[model samples]
Target: MDAINLVSARELARRNGLSFPNESPEYRQARDELLAEEIELRRHIERVAEQRRALPPGGQVRKDYRFQGPDGEVTLRDLFADKSTLVIYSYMYGPQRERPCPMCTSMLSAFDGEVPDICQQVAFAVVARSPIERLLAFKKERGWHHLPLYSDTTDEFSRDYHAIGPDGGDGAAYNVFTIKDGVIRHFWNPEMGFATADPGQDPRGAPDFMPLWTVLDTTPDGRPPSWYPSLTYGSGP
Candidate 1:
């Protein structure tokens, strides 16, 4: 069988049956152009993911990092359970902070519902520097039921994964690890930081993990420059 070539994004858009009745010609033209760009962006994201999956073997994990969970002490290897992949999201809730980072809380809020489905393919856990009791209390207060919360009681995991700065400030970090043939190794992380951010944009990891900013981006006002998530707000409407 002869291999068929894919059509250009613009051609694909032109051939699509989607239509909005009573829409102006200008709107159609603009929409079609945007559609093509969206197609290209989707392709680019796939390419980047492919590249990530093709990365060479990452650094070997030498330390047996321990975490405090509701069930008691669990090691780094134990987090993987039966899955080969493990995703750890380091929430910015350290012992010194009176409250957790609103940004991390917002992201975790979204993840709470996804944990069940996500865990089907890979093990997932949220780690923080706070005590296990405090972490669990906040988890309950925020109404998060599915997200597995753990405490990096000794701060080693946080420091090793760059979740805590040299000065001891907490930060949000996402890291993936792989366990193969009884060997645990680092996989990939979004190393982008404040210093590498583009002008007029906040420092964001590639493929922005949070859905909040992605949803806000569709608004006319877009994401506010000064506005950010808050730990608490006044009484509900």
Candidate 2:
């Protein structure tokens, strides 16, 4: 849709007749105004996604990185499977840590349910710098049946993809790759990080992927400043 030809968000919001049982005039007025902004926010999100889809082909894969999957070993190209596009999420789980990153695990918990749907379009996999057995054990513990877990035992892929920091610590990373004409190439990844973060805000990618934050954003309280997810909550997994 062309923005130039679209109706104004304010006009659309004003035309909206949605009302609650006990909403006052003041509440309705403010809600309509907020609705207009929400409409614009939706459009901006689509605009950004369109821009991303229009990005030119990215760099080619330099090394033949290997990973240990449930079945056996696999290479980067093999990750694509039968699809042309592949999505790899590098979680913060390494040999040194007794548990996986709470944030990453929280995000993946949501993703586990969506993997089946996501894989219908593009291949998706989760890679971590832990042994295959350890990764699978955690998967079983979390009851994530659909998420494809792999171990980056050699750390080659993690090191090249920024999952392994210069300090040798594990970091969360999301990357996309595409295969064309028998050649695999990088697609896109969130480039914003600590260096690019706005003052007083933690570094985050546009259209945040975490559903936890997205849901919280709709509430009056929003996401708390210091609050974070724990591996287990109230003695429950």
Candidate 3:
């Protein structure tokens, strides 16, 4: 059988054997329609990924930016390691702030566990504008031993990559770079930010990268507008 286009989403949803207790006909009808839409949404995600993979080569990275990692100083090219693909997450942890951005920290915390598996296919690093010691200390405090943290001490990388705003504030950025024949080039980065957010929605890239947001999006509550992740949650009455 062909990998795709085997069956229509509506047909698949209708054939589902799942039935909940005390479900009315009205609910079932609406649920079946929703399931069909969900199936279509999954297919659309795959299509978007395929197109992204087929994109033409991005801008070449000519400058030799330096960063301070746990193992000492390293260049941007050094980040590729043995892998042709490199993924760097520019976290909001600049020296100006007493603490890192909670949202960025939350996202990185989730990535900590997935680092091992993800590194199998790509070299991944979490970069910040703070000093190496501060970055490492925070990593340890977060118990993120698997994540490879780095400090963009000079702000060269962050500035060039648009990870830092013009106001000298830090922001979250996920960038992918490709290396071939000793030449490094940018691959992809989501440009969506607060400016691109719809009237009632928070700015988020398609196929959201954060697991917390993804999970919350599936619930009936559907990611409350005011709800956000916090660095520490106290168990108070």
Candidate 4:
């Protein structure tokens, strides 16, 4: 049996919580099953992460663009920070959009403090179409001192990677790459709940990386479809 058998999404949502659909009995049942599945899923995530680390760093992605740094402007090639593996998190900040992506921000909240340890092994950075000045200002506003933000304002790197939604539109993503012989290649790119929807089971496993799942653990009901409001500006979950 699932861990949360006594509650329903409707009941969960009643008290400032958003969860399974109130009209669908099946959605509620599936939501309950997800609780136990999530536990086993976390172990699976550990294995997949191990697999990602085992992949002898495939492909060579070579593209050049300019970026803004703490000191001044820099180039895309400089983003490697001398590491073999470069992880690029496509931030949702864009020219048309006014606010940073609440989801991306939540995923990053954990990494913000652990970046020092991560930088020692694998290099990571955040890329966005937003101007360097604008991105930096928001970083300050959010107190994100650990991340290295970059701009792809002049190049099609974001489009090439499908990081953005449309031409001059908006989207966000998590893309990883490997550089070899002055060329970089795509390795892994994971999207929210996308792996589970795959047919080949290539997604392999699941985890509570999504904030909704974590919040659901505490309540009898699960999470809501409503936007994930920012915790950076607000208090508590």
Query: Cα miss at 148, model 4 (Å)?
Result: 1.3
* Number of clashes found in candidate 1: 0
Question: lDDT of each model, Cα atoms only?
Answer: 0.92, 0.93, 0.89, 0.69
lDDT of 3 at 104: 90
Alpha-carbon deviation at 199 in model 1, angstroms: 0.1
lDDT of 4 by residue, 80-127 (tens): 879977788777877777877787777776667778998998888888
Over 4 Å off, model 2:
none
TM for candidate 1 is 0.96
Better of 2 and 4 by TM-score: 2
Ranking of candidates on lDDT, top first = 2, 1, 3, 4
* lDDT of the structure predicted as candidate 1: 0.92
lDDT by residue (1-237, candidate 2, tens digit) is: 599998999999989989999989999999999999999999999999999999999999978899999999999888899999999999999998988999999999999999999999999999999999999999999999899999998998998888988799998999999999988889999987899999887788887999999999999999898899998888788
Clashes of each: 0, 0, 0, 8
Better of 1 and 4 by lDDT: 1
Judging by TM-score against the true structure, name the best candidate.
Answer: 2
Tell me, by lDDT, which candidate is best: 2
Ranking by TM-score: 2, 1, 3, 4
Any runs in candidate 4 off by more than 4 Å, and if so which? 1-43, 50-57, 191-208, 231-237
Determine the backbone clash count of candidate 2: 0
lDDT of 3 by residue, 1-237 (tens): 234656998999999968899999999999999999998888888878888999999999999989998888999888888999999999999999998998898888889889999999999998999999998898888888798889998898999898999798997889999999988999999889898888988889886888998898789988988988888889621
Number of clashes found in candidate 3: 0
Error of 2 at 140 (Å): 0.5
